[model samples]
Target: MEMQVWASLFGVILGGLLSYLAQFTTVRLAARNEEKRQAAQRAEARRSERLELLREFIAITQAGIRIAEERDQAPDWDAAGTPEWFAAARNIIDRLWVAERMIEVLFSPQMYQLARAYASAVDHVLWRLPEQIAAEGSMWDHLRGPQHEFLAGARTDVGSLP
Candidate 1:
C-alpha cells in the first residue's frame, strides 16, 4: 500500500515537470518564429522600397534622355540641362536619398550597404547628367549606358511602369 502511494506521487511529479518543460519549450519556439517572421517582413519591405527607388531613378533618367532627344538637334540645341530636367533630376536625387534612409532602417547592415552603393551609383550618374549632356555633345548616346544599368537593375519592378 505504501509503495503504491509513493509510485503515484512520483508519477504526478514527473508529469508536472514534463508538462512544464514542454510548455516552456513551445513558448520559446513560438517567440523565435515570430522574430523570424518579423525580420523577413522587414527585409521584404526594404527590398520593395529599393525596387521602387530604382524604378523612379530609371524613369527620371529616361525622361531626361527623352527631353534631350526630342528638343536637341543641330539648330535647336537646347542646353541639355534645362531647368525642367534639372528639377526632375533633383527630385529624383532627393527621393533616392529618402529611400536610402529607409533601406538603412529596414535592411540588414550588409544589404543596406549594398543597396546604398547601388543607389549612390545611380544618383551619381543622374546628377552628372546635365553637364554630360550639354558639353558640346548630344546626351542620347551617353545616356544609354547609365540607362541600361538602371533599367537592368530595376527590371523586376519596371514591368509595372505604364
Candidate 2:
C-alpha cells in the first residue's frame, strides 16, 4: 500500500513536469512566429518607403530634363541667366541633392552611383546652358543617355525586390 502511494506521487510530479515543458515550448513557438510576422511587416514598410523615394527622384529628374529641353529650344539664350531661370534650376538642383542623399542612404552602391550619374547629367545641362548656347552646341543629347541608364537601373532594382 505504501509503495502504491509513492508510485502515484512520482507519477503526479512527472505529469506536471511534462505539462510545464509543453507550455514553455508552445510559448516559445508563439514568440518566434510573432517575431517573424513583425520582421515581414518591417520589410514591407521599407520597400514602400523606397518605392516612394524612387518616384520622387524620378519626378525631380524629369523636371530637370524639361528645363534642359526648354533651354535648348529657347531662341533667346540671354534668358538663361535670368533670375527666373536661376530659381527654377536651383530648385531642381536642391531637390536632386536631397534625393541623391536619400538614395545613397537607402540603396545599394550601384544604385547610388547610377543616381549620381543622372544628377550629374542634369547639373551639366542646367549649369552649362549659357556656354552651350554661346558655342551653338547642345547638351540635351548628352543628358538622354544618362537618363535612360538611370531609369533602367531603377526599374531593375525595384523589380528585383522580393
Highest lDDT, which number? 2
For each candidate, the alpha-carbon lDDT, in order, equals 0.60, 0.86
Candidate 1: Cα lDDT at 117: 57
TM-score of each: 0.60, 0.89
Q: What is the lDDT of residue 107 in candidate 1?
A: 39
**What are the per-residue Cα lDDT tens digits for candidate 2 across 1-162?**
999999999999999999999999999999999999999999889899999999999999889878877877777876656788789989999999899999999999999999999999888777774666558465757777888888899899899875
Screening candidate 2 with a backbone cut-off below 3 angstroms (N, C-alpha, C), the clashing residue pairs are: none
Winning candidate number (TM-score): 2
Residue ranges of candidate 1 with Cα displaced over 4 Å: 78-138, 153-162
Compared with the true structure, what per-residue lDDT tens digits does model 1 show for residues 1-104? 99999999999999999999999999999999999999989877766776665555445445544443544542543465578777866776676667667656
